[model samples]
Target: MRHRYGFTDEACAFFDFFAAPAPELADRTLTALQHALDTATLDHPRALRYGRLLQAYELMFWEGLREG
Candidate 1:
């Protein structure tokens, strides 16, 4: 997938992060996402570029849960 996107070698590792096992938190997937975003920021500063997108994902996830 990284190759398909033409991401550089350094960025390949950042893309690999999506393969990590989803963090488990019972009914708090939002918290899990927060944790992921934090870890991504720490693990790959470049991830900062996606902070807003990640926040959007978190919002959408919470909305889905609320409407569930």
Candidate 2:
């Protein structure tokens, strides 16, 4: 399924990674996201911008699921 925010590869990877329930998988996902955010290059500003946006979207999505 395509995501509402935008179906980029990163978003698809995130959704696929989280489709199954596993504590270690969550840790791995967080680690991968942090690495991407930390290493995004200024030369490619869109990488950083999109990374942050996706991060925000993921947070909001989990928050909404928790609330609901």
Candidate 3:
């Protein structure tokens, strides 16, 4: 996907995570999501809501990869 500011090579490659040619891209995205979940906290107001959203994204990614 092109943008006015343009994407970094890594960012462009990330979009191809579902491609079979490089499954590692998907793995890396999953790992990053896992890390975000691990370090997430509820120390601030409305943090719970954001945390839930992040958790949901992680679950979706995990299931997507698993099903593929």
Candidate 4:
């Protein structure tokens, strides 16, 4: 079976921005994203949202690399 998921324009932009980097930079990107997530405070709603978005993109980037 196949599944479909919908993403907002903001989410699509996030994915596209990260997806442009070379495959070799995936690890670096993940590391940077992790650092940002770790440093982001829960009190700031926008920061938390972006941190989660970065995490999602990190997973997607890694999976894309594995498949390609």
Candidate 5:
């Protein structure tokens, strides 16, 4: 089986926006879900979030699926 980090670079950046440097301590669940969905920068919010949910298994899932 394969595994990937629970958080992505963008997720870390999202956590940093609030924690400053404690992404590890950041809540990856719904607590940060909204912000993530908001900052996904994707043309399609639904699709971007869907990908983020699986980014670890496949970085391409949400790597550039979002818009700026």
Candidate 6:
């Protein structure tokens, strides 16, 4: 079956994160996102730009996942 929108491997990897009964992927995602936000703030001089980008990606991920 073809979906109107589709997910890539990297996104599936991230979305499958909350499936476990533990916190490994979630923890890693949190840490990575936090670092990205901080780095973007210091390097890009844009407040919350990286965070917003990540949020946009997450939103798009959910949209694609649910499109099937």
Instruction: Using lDDT, give the best candidate's number.
Output: 2
Residue pairs that clash (backbone atoms under 3 angstroms), model 1: none
Task: Write one digit per residue (lDDT tens) for candidate 3, span 1-68.
Answer: 44755777687676566444564768996786677678883244465687689879977986996697
Residue by residue across 2-22, what tens digits does model 5's lDDT show? 125577666677434643444
> Tens digit of lDDT per residue, candidate 4, span 1-68?
01235666665675566657667688996786688679873345776788799989989877996797
Q: Worst ten-residue run, lDDT, model 3?
A: 14-23
Badly placed stretches (over 4 Å) of model 5 are 1-43, 56-68
User: Which residue window of length 10 is worst by lDDT in model 1?
Assistant: 18-27
Candidate 4 — what's its lDDT? 0.70
Superposed Cα deviation of residue 31, candidate 1 (Å): 21
Model 4 lowest lDDT segment of ten: 1-10
Cα-based TM-score, every candidate: 0.30, 0.39, 0.35, 0.35, 0.20, 0.38
Task: Report lDDT (Cα) of residue 20, candidate 6.
Answer: 56
Model 1 lDDT per residue over 1-68, tens place: 45565778676675355446556644485676579787774444545557678879967976895697
What is each predicted model's overall lDDT from 0 to 1?
0.64, 0.75, 0.68, 0.70, 0.56, 0.66
Cα displacement (angstroms), candidate 5, residue 20, comes to 34
lDDT against true structure, model 1 = 0.64
Residue 7 displacement in candidate 4 (angstroms): 36
Q: How many pairs of residues collide in each model?
A: 0, 0, 0, 0, 4, 0
Best by TM-score: 2
How do all the candidates rank in terms of TM-score, highest first? 2, 6, 4, 3, 1, 5
For candidate 4, what is the TM-score? 0.35
